[model samples]
Target: MTKILVVEDESAIRSFIAVNLRRQGYDPVEAASGEEALAVMEQQQDIAVAILDVMLPGMDGFAVCRALRERFPAMGMVMLTAKGQEQDKVQGLQLGADDYVVKPFSPKELLARIESLLRRLERPTVELGSRQEASFTSGPFIMRPDQRKFYKDSREIELTPREFAIIKLFMENPKVALSRDDVLNSVWGKNYIGDLKTVDVNIRRIRQKIEDKPEDPKYIQSIWGYGYRWLGGD
Candidate 1:
């Protein structure tokens, strides 16, 4: 059974989520604080997903999310933010979380988000008769989809799974102005329920990693009123 970590200070809420997860056949490991969550992660390295509540007693979910992202790049994460906390949502995404669910969210919605994330994280396989995937090269950057590795100027840049997917999409469609919907659909799936600003936040995070000047991005250019375009080549 897949294991999911639920870190929420409120015991009632945490228990509620755990029960729902268990009903869906997931083994949920519960924690009451960020510190405990990290400890749980240390002991259970095989945990597939973490659902972190933003308002915690200590350390807070954002900090925990950052720590988890740095320690386990491939593990999926979903932030639980209070409804109307727009900044919290953006901060979680910027900190490498795959998705966010507002408080007062239904179990169905939460499960859907988790299911979508798991789908995104699933490793791709090459069939016996299929051609091997090729590496993408854009100027100094190289991305190997099969290896799930990305490098710039011979230096490897660590990226979350979502970040990798977004960059791969941009590289695959170089010089084309892709609308926000295009990116959201390609990376987050068409059934994703969230703000379009999620796309902008993710793009900003990517620029910080790849651009020398994120304030004035060179490779990932903004299309203004549309979305963004990738400008990279030999």
Candidate 2:
């Protein structure tokens, strides 16, 4: 059974989500606080997704998301934010969350987001039946799809699953200007119901990891009023 962690301080909301998850055949691990969520994670290493509520008793969802991203780069994360809290949504994404759900969201909507995340997490980094195509290099960066690893100048750089997918897409289509919509459809899928800002935020996060000066990125250059392009080569 697939395990999903639900961190919501409200008993009613937490129970509501857990019931829905159980109905869908997922094993829901409930945590009332961020601290408990971390404790649960320590024991439940098999947890594939974490649904974190932004308003928690202690150690807010942002902190938990950051810690989780640092400790478990591959684990999928979804933030539960109150409606109209745009900053919370952006902060969650910047902290390595794969997606966010606004308050008062239907169970179906939340489940859809979770399923989308699972699909991305389960996707093969490289196509099967092509051992020779398992790895690729662009300038100083090396990506091993089979191993799900990336390195810059021989040093491993930890990337969340979403970041890895975005970078892989960029590296594969070097020099081609890809609009935010293009990246959203390719990485997050066409069915994704989110703002285009998601693409921008992820790109910024990727730049922070891969570029020496994120403020003035050399490899991933933004095309004014359009999109972004990757300049591959040393």
Candidate 3:
């Protein structure tokens, strides 16, 4: 059973989420604040996912999500915010959150989002029977599917789970022009509901990490008004 970290200052909402999580057979570890959530995570290293409230007491959910991504790149993150504004959702995703739920969200919707995140996290294997190789190589990039490891110019690049998925999708389908919708459907899951610009934000982040010059990216190129395509040489 994967343990879930629930971080919310409001006692009633915290308990409500924990109870629902329990009903769904998830073991939820609760925390009343961002600081306490970090402490809890330190004691419990097995936490697979963290449900973070944007309106945290001190650190705030954006900061927490950023911190947690650095500390545990593999762990999944979902942001909970009362605001349904597109900017809030975009900011959370930019900070490495896997998903976001507006406050007063249906329990079923929340659980479904959680399950989607978990499923993506568990994708530890990518079979390539036809091309027997230790890793997939394109230009200066090398990806070890089994290890979820990525390297550029022979230097390893640390990636959040979301970033990893986005990069892998591009690497696997090099030269194919993929629209924002295509990227979102492939990386964020088909059920994801958000602005198409979310894909652009993620792509920009990935470019910064992997490209020699993000301003003039060599591998990822925008196709005028259509979308983006990978130019990495195989």
TM-score per candidate, in order?
Answer: 0.96, 0.95, 0.92
Q: Candidate 1: minimum summed lDDT over ten consecutive residues — where?
A: 123-132
Q: Candidate 3 has what TM-score?
A: 0.92
Model 1 stretches astray by more than 4 angstroms: 126-131
Candidate 2: misplaced stretches above 4 Å? Answer: 123-133
Angstrom error of the Cα, residue 232, model 2: value is 2.9
Cα lDDT of model 2 by residue, 147-219, tens digit:
7789999999988888988988988898999999999999888988889999899989999999999998998
Tens digit of per-residue lDDT, candidate 1, span 86-176? 9999999999999999989999999999998887777644554676578899998999888888999989999888898899999999999
Reference-based TM-score, model 2: 0.95
Clashing residue pairs for model 2: none
Error in Å for residue 210 of model 2 = 0.6
Whole-model alpha-carbon lDDT for candidate 2: 0.91
TM-score of 1: 0.96
Across 27-128, the per-residue lDDT of candidate 3 in tens digits comes to: 999999999999998999999999999988889989998889989989999999775577778888888887889878888888988988888887567457
